[model samples]
Target: MSKTEVNIIDPSILEDLCNNVTDGKPVNFELPNHGILHIDKLLPFICVYRYSELDFYFARVIKTQASYIIVDDNTDISHLLEGIRLIMSAKFETFLVLECWPISSEDYTTFEIFCPAGKAPSTVKALEKGFKSLNETYPNIAVEVNDTHARYPDQLEPLLNVEESKKTGTLVIGLGIPTLYKNSKTNELYALFFREFYSVFSETIKRAIHEFIRVQTTDDFENYLMFGKTNIDEITLTSDAELAEISEGMSFLLRTTPVNSNEEWTNFKKNEFKKTPEFKYRLISLDSEIEKRKLYNIPIDKVDDPTIAFILRGKRLEIEKQLTMLEERGTKNFRFVGESLYGVIKKNVLEEAKHILAVYPKREERKSKERFNCHEFAAHAQKELDYYNTKFPNLDLTLEIRNDVAGIMVSKSKLLINNEINLDANRCDALIQHEVGTHILTYCNGKRQPLQQMYEGFEGYDQLQEGLAVIAEYLVGGLTVNRLRLLAGRVIAVESMVNGATFIRTFNLLRKEYGFSDRISYYISMRVYRGGGLTKDAVYLAGLIDLMAYLKAGGNLENLYTGKFNITHIELIEELLYRKVLKQPELPRFLERESVKERFKKLRNGIDITELVN
Candidate 1:
């Protein structure tokens, strides 16, 4: 490890390190808890010196996560080691500190409280108040709360791990929380409140002793939410053009390992679901697909990039799952797909939709009707395709009408419109933008990159793809109230299926309670129940939620427009662009149109779905 990794600063080596090293470079240190800290620069924050032998560096936290932190410092060696102790003493095992800062003499003491941004203000006040009240009672042990600084540490995993450890009954220091632990050993919910102080004097000890005697209950544990930050596993990054090759070779497995897309499955399930059903069906055996999948097994163990390896592994697993389901339809199909897509709806997401459905009233149909037959609709859709041609002269897009597809973008170059379904005139504009502007545009943009996965997309790409498509409807002033309700109803119906509700039950729930038309309800319910419980329909609303949050969080829509991507890849995609590993999007000039720009602003500014239609 480099010198910057440790938080310890010895005045003896301070000048030596400063003179030997240039500013704005990374320094590393080995932490006792098996962690590494990479200080980007010793950013001249603050310094404390005592006795010719002792010194300190204070680092301002810039970006904090669970297990690592990137700190900026002008210079320090030992101060980083000290910071490591500070982090671990808060009950984290290992962490990385990237950058540096710190302080004075005259017997000054520092008490730092690390908490989430939302809780920082309150935590500071509460800690100060608790100390002040203690000081008022015992004047001899009184100390002023002098300085407070908010920091962003890159490593948050260890701190979060500390919370999990508390499930057993461990007392953590530096973290200001009165934990009410459920004592598993005693088979009871027991709360143990501990106030720990690692101060220089005995005053902190007296306070800790007093608080230690306080037997906290499970009720008090809920109030401690203010003391910690929410943490997620860190996203590992790599710049391996090799991933493009590996992904390309593996892509063939997906085509052969397709899920049930036959209209018969939908019709039969909808028809049979009129009764309590244990419906079964025969599928062409997946013997060939399974053998091919095995032959093209992902070399996950050998992939150098952990992130890429993980993603490839998931893709391979999904392919295998889909292949297995083809051989075993019904509950087996439902089980495999649900497990593959992680289709199990969480309680919170389910409740959120229920709330929307309560107030999301349906709308009268737009003046435009599905009056055009198949050939006429194909001719009409061609007009929209012509409009796109003028904008993307080199896009090489093809449009064809088919019985199987309902306006699906195929092979990133072809748009297939279902010839059997009537075309809704009002929705043609929305479908044009959804299919041509959003889907085809992303496919074209992704084609500019070396990675075909960008164009073809990775697993779980449907959520982002469909979300952007649906949002396009809203952007173009065609997101009818009925359409938005349909999206919401899908979520409700999906939740019902996951909860073991049958097709007919979900259909009635939508038609009777939500007032959807019989045909609309039947189709929506069919979507959820098809192929032994496909949860893909739920992605419409879930993807919308994710996209909305991304926009609100200052995410650039251009990143998403660049390819078939997941919200989780935003950072990596941007990083790739920054490193020239990925190319910037080549969007059509129509995006710059004033009307589209206005729509972009509306999307960027934010939207409330329930009120959006009105």
Candidate 2:
């Protein structure tokens, strides 16, 4: 129903209630939220004190209380919902927007009108409150009823006449339920709800959002979700089994023990070999993996879908590159920098490193007793795992001490810790947030996806993965000046290796010029020269710079959190979702955390980490 359908029996009542809103004094309406919504000098301005309750958006609600519409100073709706994190049921796109007038509760009386269309349990309670106000003040409710619900009673009531019973003659049409539109402030809920609908939602929500869109807003939120669907049961042109096999196959082939035995490397360092250290690495089943990939034989030309072809071919390329990296792992002039092009530190990265180096030359240390042992880190990892598993009860997590990685996320369900090193308690939380919070979280979310490559990672994924890991550090407040300097040092190390600088040269640069401790310099140099000029470490700082720019531009981190997505892959991920090729990422806890929203806001407004240290 449009405004023309509304018949306000007592126009003076609504006007009188609205008029009660005073400039000198404002009326407060409590939300089912964490804070109060203050309506003062009603119509143009409303303040949501503790507005963080709804999400991250900090705003003054806009004009036209009758419509509950909010707009920026320029009336642009874009900024209103930008970066808003709405927490809602994943079932539907339809939700209610609360609007409280200055009218006293004493003047309100409640009664129900049968509104079958608006009868969803999620919305009816709020409807009841608004109805009570309307019934007490006005003789007839001013509601915009959709054509379907209006016709529903017409069809049912007449059919009842066919029964010719006493009950059939007694009929009361339930209409006049007011239609509510989410103004700019509340409008973000629709965008967020739609994202949930697909990432995703249940049937009731779809219907509710569709009905709500038709009855309330002038926009087409429902049709937009439908997105040219010919029918409801749409399926994509891809095979889950095929993708899963390829993912499993590559992971199987990628296995290997550490390149140089830890003992031999310890001796090499102890010998003070004033040259590049040499070691050996071998792929366990190189031939078998090659045979399997050949059998998968990606037929790009035969593939009807470009996305399927691209993903398959990309996986094949990565497989071949990974094989080469493994085969060439420890030799003189050996460059096993897997996907090194994506890891290049650019001019901006160099500039940022210079800034970081200038700011954090002095190393910070925690007291020895404050250092947490391996068991303590395990406790922390377990707690972080518990936090994750609590959020998603189905995730079966396994914790194990492994020598292969310092702290590696093996898969959606497995975590590998070095077990040899004690951790600083101060750094443990950030590590958990980095390893478990980001890697494990994204892995689990990817597992929930229909596409297996989500967890496995696609081409160009390394940059964003490490970038997000570093950003997760910043968001969780674990990124200290020393940590920032460490990342900067990695960029410097990788740069030195890229330019064929010797390990000794890189070590000395970090130790003397950068003022890094010999231990720290040795560690950074070893990582960069691990495979004789591995440029992969460059991604940590370079990716941080790129991801920072992305965040500053209001890119939703939740999308990246959905899977092991590269920044470049965001569009592809969206397209895959649009074509039903991939499922929406399941757990985007990073975006959902209230603790990080303010940080994101600060980042969006622009921040400089190097400035903090000095």
Candidate 3:
């Protein structure tokens, strides 16, 4: 009947795919020994791959999984074709089968397009346009266009019946890519470059598919981003969990903060601020190499979902940086790694900090008649936790007043307080909201999310989280000029340290030049100089500046509460929430306050950082 003898695959496989697609459900499963078939929804196209000699290279390149089919042998090819027809019958008026293969070319990297003779010319042009446009990103890669009677790879008969395909509203295009990811002579893969190329190449295909859908089909979607995999696989989930496990085992901040902070400050001052203080950090019991090895063991490459893989890969790089910083602590390399991780203090940030130190008068500092000790503050913090527990019920938080910890900090889900901490009774509520309301609140929100990395803290999450915490202080009507000055002083101190200023020199800059009191100056210098000079303190002021601008532009505060992520992640976070991949988070407790509501209204209407001072 047809030129190519059609081999009928097992009917059960076709039945499973067709039934799920017809019912408007996702299909993800192995086609027995054929290969994997995953469809996020009823998209109008399918990216198909049949096993070949360049299996390793091609398998890694075709990343569009919204609707895809991969198979091994002749029987598997039959299954793939049948499955494509089944999907077309169940869901679409017009369909596209984008089959890709790898060609062994020792000369150079090129993409060759093979369009079947009968398809619309516009459709063929769209495919050629997509391949040609890759020149913008990969200028060295050449693109060639050709017409073919059969749209299939080498040594394989046409997988689809041409006459029947036309009647069924199906079109097929064959793409041949030279194996540029491997050494033509040795056949060894350039793994890192291949990964980068894979991401770009995948986007190219989606761009082509986007144009194809616009010209050929009436399928409705916003953009090529909709082609990204909506469903994360078991490999992605487990890999994320394993990386989070390694991150949780190492508390970078806690391990890096000097254990003998008070002693070092006292000795430094006792030495009349001449010699640099040697800060003693908490000894990491776990071997750094072993921990780094654990990070390496994560199978991030096995993850097929592009979005999730990108996020996970970023986290792994950050973890590796932290581990290296830990191993290099107390050495010259420590500060270099720290600068790379936290970022160097920018000129604008330094200018802003200097302006705050100059403009904010010392007279604006709050005058309090009563001061409370750590015990009183701990009691107040526990009461605040009690209030949140009523809302969340199982909100688990611990308050530990440790001798080693300086000031108040939230680590993991625990609020750590310095045993010798003294606070103005007036500012207690502000401190409570900053530590518990923001840090612990977001951590709790992250726990409810599907990704464990959210709870542990996504890479670069500190900036947004700290910025939101400072906003909490302002909302509770406790943000004071003195507190603003304190935050600004930290930025100045970090800038000095990054500029090669010694501890004693930075101490004098804060004390003598900036008019900071001895106690305030000592603490600021210690924090910046700790772990051989950290630039992290600058984020508080930097985050606040960026957040003020974000709010000025009408950014949503409720979205920041979704989980611990950087401001850069807003779009991706929103996309995930839109796809129902991430659960929508409830507003934080502080947002419920009438005072907070009034304050937020002003914030939304564009309030300046200086204007936020209570």
Model 2: runs farther than 4 Å from truth?
Answer: 1-248, 251-261, 273-276, 280-283, 288-296, 331-343, 367-369, 407-411, 577-582, 586-595, 611-614
Q: Which pairs clash inside model 2? A: 1-145, 92-205, 196-200, 197-201
Which structure among the candidates has the greatest lDDT? 3
Separate clash counts for every candidate: 56, 4, 0
User: What is the per-residue lDDT of model 3 for residues 430-481, given as tens digits with 9 covering 90 to 100?
Assistant: 9999988888888887888888887787788898888888888998899988
Error of 1 at 383 (Å): 4.4
Q: RMSD (Cα, Å) of candidate 3?
A: 4.0
Question: Candidate 1 — which residues are off by over 4 angstroms?
Answer: 1-296, 305-307, 383-396, 406-411, 588-590
Q: What residue runs in model 3 are displaced by over 4 Å at the alpha carbon?
A: 1-8, 18-28, 32-34, 76-94, 108-110, 113-137, 142-150, 166-169, 207-220, 263-278, 361-363, 367-376, 387-395, 553-556, 592-608
Q: Estimate each model's TM-score.
A: 0.55, 0.58, 0.86
> What would the per-residue lDDT of candidate 2 be over residues 1-614, giving only the tens digit for each residue?
23223221222423333434422233333323223323332221111112112322222111112112221121122122110101111222322332121111232322223434543433343334433443333445333333232321221222122123122111112322111212343333333322221221122222333444455334444332232121111122244345446556655322433445455457656877465555454455546456456635644323323344456556656655655565565654346435343445689888898888887777776543588766778877897787778766877876788665533445556777776767677778778778887888888888777666787777667779888887787776667778888889988887777777887888888988998887678777777776545676777777778788888888877678777867777776765565344556655355567877767688888788563221
Root-mean-square deviation per candidate:
14.7, 19.4, 4.0
Ranking by lDDT: 3, 2, 1
lDDT by candidate, in order shown: 0.51, 0.52, 0.78
